[model samples]
Target: MPEAPEADLAGFVRAHDPDRFLCTLFAPAAARPALFALTAFNHELARAREAASNPIAAQIRLQWWRDAVEEAAAGRPARRHEVATPLATAIGAGLLDPAALLAMIEAREAETEEDGLETEQDFVAWLRGTSGGWSAAAGRALGADPEAAEVLRALGAAYGLAGVLRSVPAHAARGRCLLPRDRLAATGLSAESVVATPHAPTVGALAAEMAAEGLEALRGARRDIPRGAVAAALPAVLAARDLMRLAAGREVPAPRGIGDRLAVTLAGLRGRV
Candidate 1:
């Protein structure tokens, strides 16, 4: 038999976002499915561009999601896709906000542009819109008031920064880099040079610098996350771990192993990062 919606969402989230998935396990049982739905929805939005064959195709997929979110927000039945079905249920239950999800979809449109991030402002905006928005929505779903949820957005952006720092070599291998041109130039690096010598000392140095910046931002944000809402914000621990690795010139973010799981669990229990 096909999986039930709750089971399907659980499996989807566990497969696509193990960090959030593990954190979701710390949530109350009644909230798990909705949280899973939110994670799944974000995953779909994230893949909208890359999953498509062309720019136009990516736009079409994003548009479809926009409409689906609007329909769900309006109390109408959403389009019958796997992610949409569960997401609509969560939105209908008032556990997730359509506007936040819409903003995330809009942010992704930038990825389709041939020219990547040009300025530091653009890079910062992308991080805020993508990861920051996601955390805000997920935070609210876990019962945080709007004020606290908004503050938690910075944690998500920190995670985004760490992700970019950790994936330097992977992105360089693809002949692309997520760092803004100005930042790269400031560090005496370029997309071409990064691609040519991904493991060079300069690349590691730049990654370390960027990771340190992200760690500082993350620490500032964590100080304000409400205790009750910390479970939803547990990804900050993983972000910190990744940022520390990048700062030490570790190319790839360390995967969650036994120790990592313990760290998140302890952080969740303590309501600290």
Candidate 2:
């Protein structure tokens, strides 16, 4: 396996996952490596499909990560690659949960399927495994107890929904749709229509409604995370901002301005998201 470009996992996080990298700035120094490791792992999973030549290749790639998770969980050295090296350390130190890691890997399989999400419930369940699982693991790594970790899991689902909305265009490019098929049909759009005309006014309307729901979820998530676990929850702030931008007819995954950075920094200082 190719090693991480370098030992500094932060470089990978900074380049590929700047939002999480920004959040990592607020984490304790000793905990930052694990944060970088997990974030890098997530970035890898997120891009696996695009990086692969075909769906089968993508599943094979994801299976490799799954095996790495099993190796780490079994207390074996799965450190041949850069991510696996630090990830194994995190698992060994018991700061991360193998189950959560497995869940994340499992959830990415949805992307490989020709059938998009059939219902809102399906979308939520997918998020529950992807970003939701990641946030819960990050919260626990930052010392959240079981209850708070569960809260973080829900918050992460909301965040993941916003992320999917932001990536509508990208998925369309791949002739895929991540929105619930029923909801898409409610807007007079089908899975094929969404892939064909991603920016249709009806699609925008549906995306707006979904964005509003995500914002509401973020509002409900407030006061759920404790001060110690707030850093992991800060992505909820980013999620809220993304939802609002989506509402305003802006392309998401856009560049973060100084104001955005300041907002996150302030939230971190206040120990809340």
Tell me which residue pairs clash in candidate 1: none
Per-residue C-alpha lDDT of model 1 across residues 1-273, encoded as one tens digit per residue? 233478877988898988889987777788788888888887887777658877789889999889989999999966677788888888999988888889989988876666678888999899888878878888888888888887778788887888777777777765667788888899888877887898889888888988988888777664567776676678778888888878887654356678778989998888766
The sequence of per-residue lDDT tens digits that candidate 2 reaches over residues 1-273 is: 555543478897898989889987888888888888899999889888889888899999999999998999999877688788888888999988899899899889987776867898888989988888888899999999888988988888888988889888788998778898888887788989988998888888889888987887778764568787787888888888888988777777467888778889999999987
Instruction: Count clashing residue pairs in model 1.
Output: 0
Candidate no. 2 TM-score: 0.94
lDDT of 2 at 208: 85
- Compute the lDDT for candidate 1: 0.81
Q: What is each predicted model's overall lDDT from 0 to 1?
A: 0.81, 0.85
In terms of lDDT, the poorest run of 10 residues in model 1 is 248-257
Q: Global CA lDDT of candidate 2, please?
A: 0.85
Each prediction's total of clashing residue pairs, residues at least 3 apart in sequence or on different chains, is 0, 0
TM-score of every prediction relative to native = 0.92, 0.94
